[model samples]
Target: MADRPTGDTSLPPRAAEFLELRPLLFAIAYRVLGRVTEAEDVVQDTWLHYQDVTERPRSPKAYLSTVVTRLSINVLSSARVRREEYIGEWFPEPLLEDPYQEPERAAELADSVSTAALVLMERLSPLERAAFVLREVFGFDYAAIADTLGRSQSACRQLVVRARRHMARGRARFAADRRAQQELAARFFAAIADGDVDQLRDLLAADVQLVTDTGGNAPAPPRPIVGVENTVRVLASVLPELGRVGLRLEPQPINGEPGALARDREGNLVQAITLETGEGRIRTIRSVSNPDKLTHLGPVADPWQLARDYRESRRRQR
Candidate 1:
């Protein structure tokens, strides 16, 4: 039985245990589902299921893990269709802060939660995603993973292997230097705010991809703008428009990567930009502008309406 919080002694022993491991359970579900709301629902559902258990488990963490994974997989089964029908490019909802922290596996933890890694994992089946996350990202043994999924150890290993093949690009990643990432991000956003197309070009890799997901709620390209020149051109064009609309950009860390948060005049978050870097330059610029995704950050504004307002303002000026 885990101890209750100081001064809150009425909390049940098992309930206290669940409270302590809530972050880990949420992390497991988030990695499996890639959506904050769904992952959180799974955690709550796990607690409800745990309350009904009559006997104590040998390991509370294992029990909680199994429950959360199962709930997350159930959600994932139905999520595939919704994702396919999503209005625009569907990226994982940006997370401003991760509750779970594995200091011993910090590098692996960071890489696994990256936007690129989550997008690539979308190719894997639901069970494969669960098994691979438990075994590879969290370093669970084969036996425990199998028990969690109610599959044979060999079957679990096969799922992980296949998942690895699908997500090979995410393998063996090391955490980037935080200071370096922040410094680079500072310069990059400064260039955007200044409308320095040439500086933006130099900061971008030769084959960078600028991807934005507005989910059709806001005006944006439906697909990624690939290559340095195209990305630079698009970025440069948007600068004046965003400035006209009074959408301010500020440097911030998003999903373990250097990124920025954009807000409209009302201080409503309009965009969460995450930058992936390699070779000392930006490789991918993922911006999640879908207001639904930005809810986690804070109040979200109507970017499409903002777009119209700014365009109308330009017309009046003309």
Candidate 2:
């Protein structure tokens, strides 16, 4: 009789190493793919590739890094094809909350995952994006990045430099004072909840736009709501009825900016809201309610502490 298939429980030592690196691998993949579901899929495919190799790698970090980089590169290459067919404007998948809030660390995480940065990255060639992210975001040295990309260190350096210049050209340099922004966001939410259209109008910038992502799965406004008056009127009309649906709103941080966490009466996290500020007025109001996008913001934690831990980890990794 054929030998019985060994369960994961009977896997060898390398399996344990793979398990240990899974979280880090997933993080890398998510940053590259911008979607949690796609990132998870890439990591699983990496694991399968690892399983197929009979020879064990001397350095699991190097092995896993190679697997993730190649997978990310492959995804990036294919993504361009699909993005061309995407409807309307394309934006990066927003992070619901900053998991690491130590100022420097949070900033680093924010820099890597921010909507602005991600959108800018879309303009780069896949190799350039990978090189820049690996070197700048993750602080991988030229030699390591070269090895991962099968290029010379000098070539990797040039790719990163080009990517940085491209990003600098496309990105807006706006610094957010979290406390002040949070206070404003709270007021914005309160205005909506109370049907204070005048307050909402005063708080919103004249050109303000509100984008809601329901993932084409739920009942959401058909098009993006634009202009302060239109946004306020639509929200004022809808929010009062949210109480009847058992949704509650709580203040939360989104992408290191002031935002809100919406939950059901049962206290399950349902959505994350972020406001963009310009010239002391809200320029944009973005609500991410697709359950898939809100997974990162489910249980809120202190942004400061999260930032601290993320910085420490990056320091140690370097």
Candidate 3:
């Protein structure tokens, strides 16, 4: 057992073990789900389920891994229903920043979070994705993967092979160099923020797409913006208004690529921006502004307080 933090909610032994392995579990869940929000939820659920178990395992890391993997598989199986009902295009929720412990190690991690890789993973069946992420990304052998997947080793191996073939066909291989990508992303945001349509156009791919998720709680364009020219125009038009609302953009990593976080006047996060790139140009811009999604990105304004404020503002307007 490890020493406990003062008033910590977790049992000392459990907390120490969980802290040691949480990052690895997060990595697995993120790859499997391709959505940071969903991945975190699965990890939390795994911890809860582990606490309920009466019997103790010899290796807590292995036991926790099994829990997260199984929970991810279950979530993926049921996710199709929700995906179908989602408004606009549904892209994976992006990460706020690179969580790698060392700057030198950013590249390898970035490759795993590339938009192309994530989109390709979405093409696979849940089982295939799980098998590939476990075996390829995390380096789990067929036997270990099979244990988590509840399949024979041979079956797991076949699943991974199929997933790899699918990815090879669909994804263009790109080298991961975080510094170069970040520099490009910085220029891209600056152009858009300045409403330089021509510059924005030059930075965007010919077939760029933009998707916004506002969750019907706020007014937003209801459809995806497609084509480079259209995307530029849309972004250029909106950039000014965002600033007017006390929102400023801060560069951050999203889904392993350079992204932007929108902060309020006091520097509270209100939105997250993720851009997908291909052939040295931006291919997609995804902005998540829905409060439900923003919570994971940063501390959000309290809902009850926001409602009260809105009511008071309405009264003042009258």
- Residue 307 displacement in candidate 1 (angstroms): 0.9
Report lDDT per candidate.
Answer: 0.85, 0.72, 0.74
Q: Write the per-residue lDDT of candidate 1 for residues 19-78, one digit (tens) a residue.
A: 889989989998899889888878888888888799989999999999999889999999
Per-model TM against the reference: 0.93, 0.74, 0.80
Show where candidate 1 strays beyond 4 Å.
1-10, 169-177
Best by TM-score: 1
1-318 in candidate 3: lDDT tens per residue? 323223355656866677677888888888888678888888888778767778777888889999998899889889867766766545566665534343564565666666557777888898999898888776777888888889999999899999989988986555545566777798898886787778888888887888777665444577888897788777776566556545578887777777888776677766678876756777778777766767666685443344354455546656
Write the residue-wise lDDT of candidate 2 on 1-318 in tens digits. 222223366667767777767766766776677776677778788888887788998888888877898898899789888777654445555565433244556567665776556767888898998888788877788888999999999899999999989998976556666567667888888887777888888999888888876565334567898897798887776676565555668876665567777776667766667777756788877776655455654553332333354445546655
> Each candidate: RMSD to true structure?
3.0, 11.6, 5.2
Name the top lDDT candidate.
Answer: 1
- List the candidates ranked by TM-score, beginning with the highest: 1, 3, 2
Model 3 lowest lDDT segment of ten:
1-10
Which model is ahead, 2 or 3, in terms of TM-score? 3
Candidate 1 residue 207 C-alpha distance from true site, Å? 1.2
Count of clashes, each model? 0, 7, 0
Error in Å for residue 131 of model 2: 1.7
